[model samples]
Target: MSSNIQIHDIVITEQLSDRSYRNRNADLEKQAFQQLAKQSSYGAQAILNALCDLTLSLCDADSSGVSLLQVVDGEDGFTWNAMAGSMASYVGGRAPRHHSPCGYCLERGAAQLYSYPERFFEWMRLVGKPIVEGMVIPLYGKDKNAIGTIWMISHRDGHQFDRYDLQIISIFANHASAALRMQELY
Candidate 1:
């Protein structure tokens, strides 16, 4: 909403004219899915943690995590339920429901790409690392309602996440949505 928030919708199927990464590695994606499937037996939290690690490695991101919608004292917000990479220490962090990028993505019901979010979110500056690029995908529940978001962030100044990265993340997001629905059932 603010001028500092520079974000745009990323159509998952439309490859950007100016690509960053070449293309998705089918072998790598297969291996990542295998890893996730193997970890599925460990339960939801484990799966979410594994997702974060996989996203960090797969996207070459500075940080990756899952943010679940939550209510604390009747105030809506998001809890960083899982995290990996440079932001691992923020695993239990909480952010406002409406003011953050993930929240906006859920509201729009689409994937979003953001650059230098801290420049607008102000509070993100506390994380100590500037987010050069932040991509967020909304996660959904079995009833087709918004549940949370899984995201990747790059701290490198000029890093550009192309369609290949989005393609991979979209798969991760589907896995995440299923996992969350399973978690809710038990």
Candidate 2:
């Protein structure tokens, strides 16, 4: 199937609510996985980009990004590898594994929501960016080890992330983890 066709299917599936949405989202996610599994290296990257876009769209957020953690010569850090939406300034940047919010999630090996200013003050101060509602979910490898984080940022005027948001994001993060591992192996 073409990328456009896949995206159209995803968009349509996302319009449903309640159990229907969950069911459709799972189906669409499965389709996405199948597509990724068959892709070449370049195609895999395209799918990863599309997945990032789909994640931001589904979350109804202004920005979304992914960070891959690496243990560098005894130090650790994450590098933003793929991203979509309005927070272009932070994309392609690198952060120390000890200092970043993404790092915090990686260390804890869990999903973290930062909807309050205090939760991400250090990130905002270090990057000189504004604090907004956002979340970070750990991206685990096939070994189930925390290897990265998938994150999204809401605009100042956008609705804050709720429990449902966290749940959906966690699902997307699972997909992201698999994709990142694929990229590493291929």
Candidate topping TM-score: 1
For all candidates in order, the CA lDDT equals 0.82, 0.62
Query: Clashing residue pairs in candidate 2, if any?
Result: none
Candidate 1 structure quality by residue, lDDT tens digits, 1-186: 456344443222233446766666889889999998887788888888989999988989889999988888898999999999999999999999888888878888888877677766778889998888888888888778888889999899878787777778888889867866676732
Number of the top candidate by lDDT? Answer: 1
- Model 1 is weakest, by summed lDDT over 10 consecutive residues, at 6-15
RMSD (Å) per prediction: 2.9, 11.2
Model 2 spans with C-alpha error above 4 angstroms:
1-44, 71-75, 117-120, 126-129, 183-186
Error of 1 at 165 (Å): 0.9
Tens digits of lDDT, candidate 2, 63-100: 78878776666767887777888765666677777756
CA lDDT for candidate 1 = 0.82
What is the Å distance of residue 170 in model 2 from its true position?
1.9
Model 2, residue 58: distance off in Å is 0.2
